[model samples]
Target: MSSGNSRGRGTGRNQGTGRKQEPQKRESILEYQKYENKMIRVKFHGGREVQGVLKGHDNLMNLVLDDTVELMRDPSDLNVITEKKRNLGLVVCRGTQIIVISPVEGMKEIPNPFQQ
Candidate 1:
């Protein structure tokens, strides 16, 4: 006698909804992908600054700095007047907590040699 009640399923639970699903939230700050392989100045915590041509980034968003140099270098070594060689190594910084990433002034966008 009560077979109708048992056969009814709860298919109308969400039938009243007329709104579309919300779109994904966009990032507030500018994304870093546009400036890949471009030279940039990154300011770290404690007022420390570094400059170099950005090489690449890892999956963790760590920046790779090639041909980098310290902001300040001692001039005493230049007085030696002898042949000396110095090699600069790569610098990597995690993007999760970088204080700032600013482009160097008067820096023109250069073509990426890797791109055909």
Candidate 2:
């Protein structure tokens, strides 16, 4: 009876530990996959940004931006990027590119501004 109890406790702890690790791998794969289906916002250096679905990526990872963008949900405000903001456009090159792929939930709301 004593040996059986110890085995049961060991099994229970192992099961709990296994459960936690399983989701993390699944979550990362889902994150990468989100770029394929959903619309993404790509921000470039020199203070330029574009909102569009990521259609393709080159060997150099330069993005091809389309003229017509399907804006699913506004990130903050519709007019977050104003006329005063400079260098804001599409077709980001290799050197000055910052691609932010949208998450599966559309736009993941975080406690504070952070990137994964």
Q: Which has the greatest lDDT?
A: 1
lDDT of 2 by residue, 68-92 (tens): 2433333476524544432333444
> Model 2 lDDT vs. the true structure?
0.47
Per residue, candidate 1 scores C-alpha lDDT tens digits across 1-116 of: 66445335433444348655567765536566766677788776654556777888755567898877545433564312233324355888777767888778665656779878
Residue-level lDDT for 94 in candidate 2: 65
Worst 10-residue lDDT window for candidate 2 reads 24-33
lDDT for 89 in candidate 1 is: 57
Q: Which structure among the candidates has the greatest TM-score?
A: 1
Error of 2 at 62 (Å): 1.1
Task: List the candidate 2 regions with Cα displacement exceeding 4 Å.
Answer: 1-34, 67-95, 99-105, 108-116
